[model samples]
Target: MATELNKGPMLGQRHVQSFLLFSAITVNFMTKFNAGVAVVAMTDAESTNPDFPEYDWDEMQRSYILSSFFWGYILTQFLGGWLCRRYGARITMFASTLGSAVLVALVPWCVSWGGWQAYCALRMAMGLFQGFVFPCIHAHLANWCPVNERNRLGALANMGIDCGTLVSMFASGLIAASSIGWPGIFYVSSGVGIFWCIMWWFFGADTPGESKLISEAERSYIENSISSSHKAKEGHAGTSIPVPWKAIWTSVPFWAYMITKCCQSWGFSTLQTEMPAYMNGVLLMDMKKNALYSALPYFASWVMAVVYLIIADILLTRNIMSITGIRKTINSIAFFVPAAALIGVGFLDSEQKTLAVVLMCTNVGINAGSTIGSTINTIDLSPNHAGILMGIANTASNVIPIVTPLLVGIMVKDNHDRQQWQVVFIISAVIFVVGDLIYLAFGQMVTQPWDAPDFLDKERSPNLQEEGYSKALEAKESTNVDEAKRKEIEAGLESEEPKKKALNDEL
Candidate 1:
């Protein structure tokens, strides 16, 4: 047992290991979103098909079926965060996926004859599992990537989320049209989710430093990050950070993130829960076209988000702007792109389907700017509790899915009413604008008030240097000091009377 100190730095393997971790993370992510994607992609055809009985295709029923998952999703945020923390990311997350997969396999069977309540219940069950996805991500990402890379790494990890939704939309369209049809879609997604569990057990590490799949240098890089973070903390905090709920909950910055998350989800979940139905029913498109068009916005948005994050990272690494600048610019523009794109949608109709779909893509793409919502402030406000804070905010976002649909349901009574959707769009845009503004006004790049070394001016108890101090270097120096003192004493003895005693002993 050499201790965490002697782990020793190795150079040049971080990028490779990061990629492997990202890939492993992606498959897990794909499993997580499979249900949402499959349902969206399957919407048009299933609703119209007489071959399937549960495929009622009624707007209210479709809306109900789709909207029901959010009920379960929103409800689980509190428990999901705690479960992830207690069980470890791999265990809790895997259980969610595995359970969801089993449930998914049962969907076609239940939905066909079991009726709306049963189907809704299944969706709720799925939501319970899905709620853990982002929280698990927050926990794992915090553990796995370094601080400097947190933004880009956060964006990359999130790419799995966006990519899963898009790929699901794309692949489900392909599969839904196959001979197996709608049920086939759920069946395939269920299988993928189950298979992913076995893969996770084999490859996933609780922390990146411990993953066998991670390269030594990568491991060293992660280990060093943990070590360096506590350099200033001395030995007070120990290996795990203490949870400070009062500070986390009462803080304005944390609330700002919650508000921003709420605003963003107010708009984003609209896309997730209702867009397929909206595109098909409101825009007067058929099923396949609905699926294809549904995916375009996410596809475009996904690409823009990655590029946006990389550029932000470049500016940060280059010192082109303060981290605050990055957060402000990203959030403002994220709001900007979507707001403009959504407004454009209000003016279009089925005759302008091409332009309308492009606008949808731009609108959602801009939400990628919400990465600040996902990564920036959580670390800034509470690095010690970012994951938990994210869980809180993620829980807040879940509130949107629950409320938005009911609001939209009342507003749109008929799915085809562009006027109603336009109102919803306006409401969503305002939410984003105001939320983004609040963030720019109050949010920041540093953690809490206590994070500053001298801010509170508490007597310098030793914990201050934990993240910042090099215990390894100190240990090496202490060993050298002890060895040198031993040598000096031995030499002095030899010089004094040791040689005479040695000869006498021999005689």
Candidate 2:
């Protein structure tokens, strides 16, 4: 095994993959959130942009358009994971982006052909194509990220969600206000998505071993840091490794994670899909103003996500907390703090616009910490099946996006009514808190028995298993020895004490 004595450049193929993942996520979300901003400009009953045609639609109809994407989104969550595991992330993500880009490019023509109904169909189709993105990315990262670097690398890749949302919200308004008008939104977004697809196809690979740009030293370092169970042959057929579906289905920790993911999605979908309506109807902001203001929370979220990543990396590297402890702690803060902020938003009236916006920003910014927690926890529990677990958990969670908008439409029948909005916020707050509590009780970082590839072949590999156990013990001892020497050096730096310090004296 490669030890601390062997080192390689921190920036390598892994970092390149991180950059590509970041770009892909940003473009994916840009397409996703374009509708959020474009709809405002399209149906702005008060707008006087003669070049852009305004649609006659009620809040209910608008809600349907906003919610339509999830119809196809919900269908492929599990399937995407399965396909990603069977094929590879490179192909899955490439196809997802390419298909979504084509649909985006056609949105304007679809609206012209059949109005809202046809446009809704297009969005559903786009969702179907984009559904493979997250599971594929998660599976790809499982192959690339070492356990120690998970928090930083995962946070870096996921930050694209916030950045993409920020750009869409900020740019969509400006684009609609430009001479190009609402159609420009779809056109520009499609161009960006297509550009990303081109880059991905040329530069991206499924794993470090497959990458032409990676160095042998860096590749060896990555392989040594990762656990044995996660190592997959570069071009092996999927039939070689059977998924432990029954074990996964029965895991309590997995269910807890699913609950937390659902709750987060509920809050996120609410903010992402309906915040514009809330700003326009209750806050009485125009489309341009709404777009600018909507961008703020996500900007704050992206910045705070960086802070969370830094802090999480520090805690892990310094041994300040156990892996499970860090995940639980960060997750609690992510959920509970956001819940409080959402509850606070409910009580703020239009008269307190600044306060309301600040609270909303606070909710999203703090919630970004979830990237380090439930988002990356899939790999912690079972690296081999990270893709499948992502599918299961995300598939369950995405149902929230479908239901949230409908429920919001019902609860806030009068979109301008602040009291009704309060009820929505309170409901979201409750879900967030409940989900965290369940995770605290059952979520874990330990690898499960089902994660093992050949647990059932005990009789055939008893001697091999024994040999592996002995090697693991040797590695553990080597690690302990290095840790002891480091502590001794630290003790020497502190004021020299005549008495020898005990093992328990150090952190």
TM-score of each: 0.80, 0.88
Error of 1 at 331 (Å): 0.9
RMSD of each: 15.3, 19.0
Worst lDDT run of 10 residues, candidate 2, spans 230-239
**Residues 205-306, model 1: lDDT tens digits:** 566545566656556656566522532123221124446555667788778878888888788877766776678666887666766887787788788877
Q: In model 2, where do residues sit more than 4 Å from their true spots?
A: 1-7, 230-239, 456-507
Candidate 1 contains a number of clashing pairs equal to 26
Q: Lowest-scoring 10 consecutive residues by lDDT in candidate 1?
A: 230-239
Evaluated at residue 170, the lDDT of candidate 1 is: 64
Name the best candidate (by lDDT): 2
Q: List the global CA lDDT of all models.
A: 0.68, 0.84
